[model samples]
Target: MTLSCFDLGERMLSVAEAQRHLAGLVGEPLAIEACPLAELSGRVLAEAVHSPIDVPQNTNAAMDGIALAWPQPVAALALVGRVLAGGRFDRPLAAGEAVTITTGAPLPKGADTVIMQEQLAFPGAGQVQVSRPETVRRGQHVRRAGEDVARGSLALAAGTRLGAAQLGLLASLGLTGARVHRRPRVAIFSSGDEVTAPGAPLSAAGIYDANRYSLRGLLQALGCRVIDLGILPDDRETIIGALRQAAQDADMVITSGGVSVGQADWIKAALAEVGELGFWRIAMRPGRPLACGWLGEGRTPFFGLPGNPVAVMVTFLQFVQPVLRRLMGQPEWQPRRLTALAAEPLASRVGRVDYLRGTYHSDREGRLWVRPTGRQGSGILTSMVLADCLIEVDADRQGVAEGEPVTLQLLNDFS
Candidate 1:
């Protein structure tokens, strides 16, 4: 059955709603693979990791110092012996005796504090004098075994995204490899007869296909394995065939354009013929005509984005990214938003949420200021290229005035 634009918009899910829906649909667990620590970057851990042993392995000096009992006064004491890292001191330090130890060196028997070398004055006759007050405390400047990570403790939780710090933690736990969820396989394409490949001569109405490349890069940044299906023309038959092929191999299929109610829009019909039509016409500007559904007997999900460049990008980031994160078994899969003052006035209609591309900066007072990139038209891809963030105007709000505080969604980290 054909779904009306308002009906689709009303049924259109919020970002969180879409994520939950997709998670329910894809309830099956993702396949986990054992990957070397080096290759596990950006992958989600599939199993909880426990530390086999304690970090530091033993009590060691935190700095180069004389290992001695605390409460020792500024009296000359015999320099008994020296202990370096990885060396054991079999002899116990008696009263009026001190042991020289370096940073990370194991504490000798009877030594309870580390006195920094600079705090002591060494005389010619194998003795030293400490002028500081009784400042040294027992067990000062020492790292105890298992203080960081105890054996059998949870080192990393399942579904944790393995980043640089996570990798280092795994290494410290003596883990050479990790079991991580397989990267989601996504197929991306752009539709429209007027869309031509870059570097080619443009016809009177043809424009370069930026959405395909842009979406591909976005998917890659999300750690998905992307299959580029290239650009499909506006023809219904060709679009359906390309989508069918993509659905057969991909976990999710994504395309831009030809989903609206216009006469030339054939993506809606093509999607219906191949799969169950879910929803279209989201309550969003530059992306209201977005469509989402499932394809194939297996119900592989698909996204039909608007033809306009800005619409394609905004819709993908707001909608499709979270679903991909769920498919990869990521625990927290939400974009962060921050409030910033509008640098200038922005005009908008009240029915749809508007994502205006803009540059964000911090003033001397540390207040965030956002200025929209000129030309808020959905067709203008250049605006997005120049923008660092998308200033979000709520669906019920008409517009924002200069110096008014509004929420800003970051597209990329500038710092």
Candidate 2:
């Protein structure tokens, strides 16, 4: 008896549910490694980082000034000594006397306030006059020790992805190395006999495989260790074999095409034979036939994206990338969204969330405007290349009128 193909429900999994499912499948924790700060970018912190010492190490001047008691009348202050950064003043400062200190220099003993050099009048003869203000507070202009970070305080929590800013913060705390989660291994492939590789001469009916390349590039941008499984023909046996092999070695397996309802599409049948098909046919345009499941005996998470070039890219960014972040132990996995005005009217069929490729730029008034690239067809890969964002139109909204507000998901912001 032949196994029957199941039509997955239109029941779309909430973004949270998708994340939890992927996390459950990728149950194994990544082994942590002590990586140098230079190599820590885009890696997840496996351990909480604590400040070993105070940020300033001591009370220091925030400006170049005379460190002395405030409210002193305009009088000659004997320049008893000078305090340079990294140099200490051992002698105590007396009343009516000022110590010349540069920015970041430690505050001298018995001196709390810092009067800027500009506030003092130089009368020559190694003396400077100060017109002190009334009711000046002690420790003014002083950056106290640990004001920014205290010793033993939590500097960064675990599961935080280290970026350039995070790296700089760790470096400021004298961290030379950090324990970070290993990159998740992802295997990418595309199916369809008509798809041919680029650089190869195309037959009369052949089409170059864009989904594989686009998905691979997106995975790379997400910092995944991608394994290109190459293209597979739409044969059940071959698809099942390739998926099983990929599931054996990869934390996740991603494929494009063969996910929709068609006689030649074999990914669903192949997944059911190897593991389990969880859901498909999400209410999203250009990607409505999205499918997800697990494969292999271990049940590695898998994503079956639509064949259209734009749909493949959009679905991966919206669904697969977040799942990858969860597998890598990142706490905040959602992409940033921004609001922009529609540059022109956008027409769409209702019932499916449409992700229209658009180019966004700020007008002189500092308002963001998004204009759809010509030919919003899903098959047009060039439109995606020319687009910087995906303008999200709701499934129930037929279209967007000109100058209307729309939420856009950035595609090339980091790049």
Candidate 3:
């Protein structure tokens, strides 16, 4: 089970090294487009956006209160004018003068303090008594100009993913649209004579193709424009032709199955004939056979993944996801991992990194715990549906005991 004991008899690349190689191969961001703010959610910014005007625009009341000028021995003040939101008192306040202002109403000139309406008593029609004058501090309850955002300052930087708060801020700045990088275009397919589509008549040896659909979902979740080419026939000409077409149209071409060095595998051969290809034996369980290269004259990136259902998912999340984000101009995207206590012992090899499907939960004391979701077989697609995360055992670790801390990659919480 160790690296030296591997049957492949060659030095396999660690997950980190393989990731670095893939990262270095991806090209720059695609073209940028001016996208409307209403449709900019999940888009990556291509350029920094600056504020045209100050947020809140002017000094205003932060709460409903009586705006007044506070003197040393504050006494009774006369309510000269009433100001609600969107209404402003024109004239400046004189000594012992006060104005009733609602939340977000502009503070009148010479008004430095505001006392809550509850703290003041309207003794007469025009007279207001301040019982807690000492509680009213200078410049209290006043929102200063440029407090939230100053004019001509950077509001959002490039590569920032637009979300609810970001869009709200842009809307406040009076911007209807923003410049963003185009979404990455992806083409996916599965190759194998045994793989067939669901709802079709199946023989005893035929298995429904699940990798393409799951890959489509994963790509869509990553905001990719996925073109599903379906299952390719197990023929050299058909595989080569499909790969060429995919490379010409997509930013990244991915195929599941036919990546291993078996007699029937044609993915590596097709890649070699159509473009540059490298078959790698990565030191990772469930997903060890991987093919990485470029295709067509434009050099579209290509990835060949294993045939196992779980292997396709693991390889995509760990390898292809980062490359796609980089091509989309997203700089902050990375795999999220957290350390949690293992609820049960798990056996693993020393040379290979293991991603075990697990159900993770938080106890009443807020401690996180994880346990395996039944079988850890690569073809058990149902196990993934029952697990929330993948417990990642490092390449150097042989096994994990109960209560031992282990790093788990969160799979369900995409946001």
Candidate 4:
């Protein structure tokens, strides 16, 4: 169903509802690509993998000690041989015999326990003394076969993003590479007559285009192949031509600074003419005006973000990041939001979801606290740079007082 921008004025969506709607719009994962294990970091696995062999593969020693036969009738046993990590005894140990074994060595046959080297006395060559035979237990300090990962058990499921641990697990299963979804190609650009590119002379009324660069950085962090279309003028035909080309070439199109319902805003008109699009006046602060829809015959997802620098970042983090992850085969990836105590008062309207940029800190007792970073204006780019998190004031609440609990969406390591 198509949602007309004109009728959505009074039917603005809450943040949660918008998330659900965008999640529904995501289709299947992009085509799979076989990536080397070394390059699989941050890529989503396209298939479930089962272990072809046991992780340990065989019974091995877990400690550098003496492998014993257990139930020692005497305190002294003759040392038969030394077992290193990759070597084992040629013959099984007879009674009253112990093998000096290092960690990770295969357990010698007939050895039921391992006594730590520190716990035994090495009086002389070929003779080892156990001070306390009662301390030895059968099956103690032994790593059994298939204990870590079974031969046929599922190691990782589809849609699992490969991190350090996941890649290590796959390596343990003897996999040299993995099948992963290809990175989504995202086309990004800034559109405004007043937006100027860096490294060029700017008119008095012009400002360097920062949104495209910032948006590209965010997209790159999410593993997208970014196609920069540069700055577009506010002319309707020029904007439409660029967007159509982007739609044809990229999996997603993202633009900043021409989506608001102002007289100078020509992108909304261009989208309306090109494809099924909707302009939403979402109940959000910093970023209220957003346009989302499909563009061109390929139906590439298009996101028209606000002009303000901070709003561009806020909206992209909240909306675009998740959509790209889902399209790349990551399932139900949600940003972590945690609770923190407010260090100062915060002003908010009851009907809007306010994202106040703030610097968070932990107290001596390990309590998290957040305080606003100067002004909460949308144009203040420094606020976002100086802040580590966004303090979320819910639409249902009026405001927050000092020491009151507030929810914070993590922007960096602080959260």
Q: Pick the candidate with the highest TM-score.
A: 4
The predicted structure with the larger TM-score, 1 or 3, is 3
Estimated TM-score per prediction?
0.89, 0.89, 0.91, 0.93
The Cα local distance difference test for each model comes to 0.81, 0.81, 0.88, 0.87
Candidate 1 — worst ten consecutive residues by lDDT sum? Answer: 1-10
Clashes of each: 0, 0, 0, 0
Residue by residue across 332-369, what tens digits does model 3's lDDT show? 57878899999999889998899999989999999999
* lDDT (C-alpha) at residue 334 in model 3: 84
118-142: candidate 1 lDDT, tens digit per residue:
8888876778777674675688888
Clashing pairs in 4: none
RMSD after CA superposition, every candidate = 3.2, 3.7, 3.8, 2.4
C-alpha displacement of 331 in model 4, angstroms? Answer: 3.0
**Lowest summed lDDT window (length 10), candidate 2:** 1-10
- The TM-score measured for candidate 2 stands at 0.89
| Of candidates 4 and 1, the better by lDDT | 4
lDDT of 2 by residue, 310-382 (tens): 8898888878777777677764557789999999999875766788999899989999999998898889888
For residue 86, model 3's alpha carbon misses the true position, in angstroms, by 1.9
- Report the alpha-carbon TM-score of model 4 versus the true structure: 0.93
